[model samples]
Target: MSDARLANARWPDVKAALESGKPIVAILPCGATEAHGPHLPLGTDVIISESIAAFALPKLEERGIHVLVLPSLAYAPAEYAAGFAGTISISMDAALALVLDIARSLKKQGFAMLALVNSHFDPANVAVLRDASETIVREIGLKVAFPDFTRRKLAEKLTDEFKSGACHAGQFEGSLVLASRPELVDDDARLQLPPNSNSLVAAFAKGAKTFEEAGGPQAYFGTPAGASAEEGVASLDCMSDMIVQAIAAQLEP
Candidate 1:
């Protein structure tokens, strides 16, 4: 295929690639349509996840791997921000089923691998992905690659604000959106959002059910004013490296 993105490629090109017998890896960028504070757009997670996949295209190509970035999955279990406007939270069961079905279709299409690049950190969403990854490999016989940044090893590679757990709509995510879509960011509001140090991770651990219960009444955390496109670019590079490494490991015999 001339383009690495399935969204832009024709069906005939994909059929040709599959018939060539070279290992074809499909990347599914997973995100949530959730609130990201008043300063950022509702599609912040979608933008970040898709950007990571886009960045990974060249790296995967350089390694002689045939890769296609699938259209981004923009809805997930985002109940934590259900109170916010424009946040579409689906059930965990529904999310899991959708991912499983996607994997099954890819397996039947003769694709060698499916790499899921998820940027949304909702606990339920993460659970669905973890389960789907294992199920896809065990049942569908598909090689699955999922770089879950929520885990400590990957989480540490991100920004300090992200590690601090006050990162929902804060500097960490805000920076990513700013890097990819600056026009979507409300600079004036971002500059005025005071830092919210409450830890979403800790709050969730204690049974907090929503953003308000997690001390994020405005549906944001961390220091948004500290965000910058430069930092965002660096973060994207780091995340893309993680995806590349994960796929490389999965491709090993």
Candidate 2:
């Protein structure tokens, strides 16, 4: 197995690893503490992000990439989900600022690359991360990348059992949580919320209503009835593969 210490490693050890010329890649898992129906845990974003990093790190290390998985950023810009219970969201500005600072710190630390594994679907925050990445690359000269897992192609690769647009606390997120943390999922508590039939892409393109207005009353937009651990595992695997490919493409040579 690869030797990538996550929570256990201290700064001195990390610095020593860097000094030894070990190929190191820092993985920052970003998530939100929000309501995910009744079944999934409030920290769904945290679970997915950390799971992806944990599962992918060893694989990357096998390819000569030393990994350092950071703790998940549990507070995301989730104003839409804030209407629901257990949704603890941060402002877009604050989320962006925090991520930017983290990116800058990673750059200053002399890490070879930084990968942000984000699980939530906050478009505003995504834009913030994208802009921050650009700024870091341009100013601090850091090599960073955030893969877009929400793409239809990646989602399809993750699950064939669910229909498209079944995101949020629906089959996609529900199933993922089941796969990663089954104990946290309570099937009886699951609820099927109305789907956002409008085209998300179009909405984004047109700069339509904010996420809060778009998600509607329940603060969710998908069918949660079909969620299963098996499906979740498939989705996680697909996401891991995508992340691996992204890291291979973006990290410095």
Candidate 3:
């Protein structure tokens, strides 16, 4: 099909692509409008997810899979960062319903697989995705894959500081944005900021309700000062691989 995104495509082109009789896959970039500390833009997760989808588009096509990159789903259950000026979180039920409805719509249009390329890391948001997508896997015939970076295999591929529990707008994410959207970063502010290594993961397990309770007063963790463009590109590759592996499994089966 055309290089245009599904959201921008004419219905005729979409139908032609669907009727091509190939393994049709729809890439949904799930992200959120939330706080990413002081140096990064609010669209960090959405930008990262969309960037990964763009990078993986040709790769998936080369592997003989017909692909459509959907517009980023820009809101999720981000209770962890609520009250942060720009953070907009949906209720858990609403988030799940949105994903389910969209997936059902794609399946109706003939997509065989729906891969969720999500980058929003709030435990609450991830939970909604895991629960909703899991139900779809069991109840629907359409294949659904969400490459949760928190999962062991994908987590291992990320940085040391990321594994430490505080990765919000830190090196891991900063490096990614630096690579894909340099204009969105404030280099001076990032380099001067000290690392906040508080483990939000630990805090969540302890029933922490907000960023401050999790020990991140400025809405961040890890070292944004150390982020580099090179690291960002490498991280992008890892995210792209997650999508490929998910689709490969269904093809093999």
Using all chains and alpha carbons, the TM-scores for the candidates as numbered come to 0.99, 0.86, 0.96
Give one digit per residue, the lDDT tens place, for model 2 in 85-156.
788878878987887787778777778777888888777667777777787778778778678766666555
List where candidate 1 sits over 4 angstroms from the true fold: none
Ranking by lDDT: 1, 3, 2
Model 3: runs farther than 4 Å from truth?
Answer: none
Looking at model 2, the pairs that clash are none
Instruction: Please write out the lDDT profile of model 3 over residues 1-253, one tens digit for every residue.
Output: 5574888888888888888887778889989999999899989999999988887877787787778888888998887788789889899899999888888888788888888998998887888889878877787667887888899888888888778888889999999999999999999899999988888788888999998899888888888998999999998987898888877777776
Tell me which of candidates 1 and 3 scores higher on TM-score.
1
**Cα lDDT over the full model 1:** 0.94
- Candidate 1, residue 89: how far the Cα is off, in Å: 0.6
Error of 3 at 193 (Å): 0.7
Displacement of the residue 164 alpha carbon in candidate 2, Å: 2.5
RMSD of each: 0.7, 3.0, 1.2
Over the full model, what C-alpha lDDT does candidate 3 score relative to the true structure?
A: 0.86
